[model samples]
Target: MATLLVLGFSSGLPFYLTSKTLQAWMTTAKVDLATIGFFSLVTLPYSLKFVWAPLMDRYTPPFLGRRRGWVLITQVLLLLVIAAMSLHDPRTGLKMLAVNAIAIAFFSASQDISLDAYRTDVLETREMGAGAAVFVMGYRIAMITTGALAFFLADRTSWNNVYLLIALLMIIGIAATFVAAEPVLNDAPPKSLAEAVVLPFADFFQRAGVLRALVVLLFIVAYKYSDSLAGSMTTPFLLQAGFSQSEVGAVFLGVGVIATIAGVVVAGAAIGKIGINRSLWIFVVFQGLSNLTYYGLSLSGKNHGFMVSAVITENFGLGLVTGAMTAYLMSMCNKRFTATQFALLSSLMAASRDILVAPAGKIIEGVGWPGFFLITVAMAIPPLILLPFIAPWSSDVPIGAAPHTGETIPARRPQPPLAVRR
Candidate 1:
């Protein structure tokens, strides 16, 4: 658990520093919103992590075996890139920042792949949910520190200094890689890069049933759609809500970050007691209903009291949902394809909005705030309706694979028997 937590920080801290944090710096420097939004697209590397993940899976890194060695390589590069990011001025060198942000994303995505592989390798099936809960709490803590803390610091210190501090923190992950032992997998390393690359998909699709497989895929892709939509609009929404800039920061620091952490802890305990699938249902409903709280705030004429309450409810619900969902996602992946498989699943989870969510402000302009919130809430329906098919966590499938479906694997054979791959 301690290792996962440190690994989470090692992986997550720079994620937003190169993303939304950089956007704020650009915004302050009088960059247009469109250009700032363009910067957000740099995160595509995360969604596409599967593209290079097989390389990590097929061969062990020289220093630390399969996972840790890759993690160390990425962490060192991440530190260097983050330090380089400090040298670029947002006003004069936005292009340079964009390039650097892409570099950070590459390393961060690699780090995430290593962590995912490590997590599956180290923990037992029964213990995975708990491990996931702990790792998420750590990851969310990193997000809170980087996202909220950097926001606070930007108001005080320069963006460069904030970034430099974040760069220094990457060392924790580097040292952890040296110390945290890698697990031994008896399975042979991939026979060839093609097999390494192609077999995971073949295994997953061939194993899980077609209908069930589609259901899982849809759930993965749609689960975060509404949240993504609302998130793309949130800062703009808050800014327009008429709170002073400092007050906005105060609310995020006070209500948003704090409630979020509390919610994660509460959800972690709930999962331990009730189990992952059941907790997931509760979390889905919590997230959907919690999103409606935003509607109430919008209609409350931007009342500060209402605003604070809504922020607390929304963020708290988000923390719980995010923590639970992460465990669920981990449960879904096959261990052999930890990097590519998870990258694909998470990409499905994130791709739609990562590409399309930016149109949110424009969508709001067409519909107005009240209507926009309602529409965003409505997007939750597809995933919510599909939840039943997913729960009892696919009663038919065994542990370590999705059930009742078979698809073809490309490299080995033409007619593969259907097997559920976890």
Candidate 2:
């Protein structure tokens, strides 16, 4: 569990460096909002990471076994690149900054791929709920560090120093890679590139069938669309609304971190008692309705109380929905293809933020903040409507259940000799 927590932090830390926090820095630096919005493209690697997940699965690096080896390499590269970010000014070196930010994102996404596979490999079915909750808590905590702490620091120090400190924090992940044991897979690693690339999809389609798989895929893509759309401009919105950096750091990011952790813990318990499908319905509603807080904040006009309330509501809902969704994704993977399968699901899940929300600034310019947030509320509804078809209230599917056979499907490939972790 400690390993998962550290790994999750490692996976999440670099995210905002290239994203929300970066946008905040740009906003503070007086960069145009449209350019900041376009900067969201740097994170496209996250949405496209499934493209290389096959490679991660097909071959083991020479050190630290397959998963940890990749984790170590990515964390080290992320540290180096993030530290290098200290040298570039967003004002004078916007293009160079973009390149380094993309490198951080690339390594960050790769780390996430390895960490997700490691979690899926190690945790038992019944343990997934708690594991997801723990991971989300860790991820959110990292967000607070990079989002809130970085904002607070950037207000006082140079963005360079802020980024350099964040780079130092990557040591937590690197140390974890050294101490953590390599997870034993039930099935062997893929033998050929063809097997790595093809079998995971084949296994998924065989287990779920064409129509059901499509429904699941659609839900994955749409479930978090509303929050993501609203979130794309949240920092800019707060800045425009007359909140000081300290106010946003304390209220929006700080309060948000606490509320989200609470939500994740509560949602984890709820998933155990009520099951994932019903949890999805409940949490998605929480997430969807929470968007109204932003609209309300817009009307309330710089009220700190409303800002605090808004951040707490929206972040808590995000935490609950995210925790439930993480467990749902883990439940879908077959052990042999855990890395590739989860990458595909999570990549699709990220498409809303990484692709669909990239144009959010243009939308906000057209509709105004309240109107833009209203559109996000509408975007959140379709996924809840999808739950009946993809993850119904009454269905009792187990992990790795085959649709046609109605039997548990074990890992297809045979186990090879265990790899040692350094």
Per-candidate TM vs. native?
Answer: 0.83, 0.80
lDDT of 1 by residue, 1-422 (tens): 78778887776787787677887888888989888877878987887788898888888776667777788888999999998877888788777788989999988888888888777666654455566767776787888889878988889988888888889998888877777766656557677889888887777766666677778787877776777787677777878888788887789877788887777777777876776677777776777777787888788766888888878988888777777766666666665666667767777777756765878878888998888888877877887787777655544222335321112121223586899889
What are the per-residue Cα lDDT tens digits for candidate 2 across 1-422? 78778888888899889988888888888999889999999988887789888888998999777777888988999999999999988788999999998998888888888889877766665566677888888887897789878988988998889999999999998998888777665568789999999999999988888888888888888998888988888899999999998888777556787888888888878887877778888888889889999999998898988888889999999888888888788888877787899999898888887788988999988999999989988987899788887678886443343221112222233588999999
The window of 10 residues in a row where model 2 has the poorest summed lDDT is 402-411
C-alpha RMSD values across all candidates = 8.4, 6.0
Quote the positional error of residue 263 for candidate 1 in Å: 2.4
Candidate 2: misplaced stretches above 4 Å?
19-41, 86-99, 151-162, 230-249, 292-304, 357-381, 395-422
Q: In order, what lDDT does every prediction score?
A: 0.75, 0.83
Off by over 4 Å in 1: 23-41, 86-98, 147-162, 356-367, 393-422
Query: Model 2: how far is 408 from its true place, Å?
Result: 20
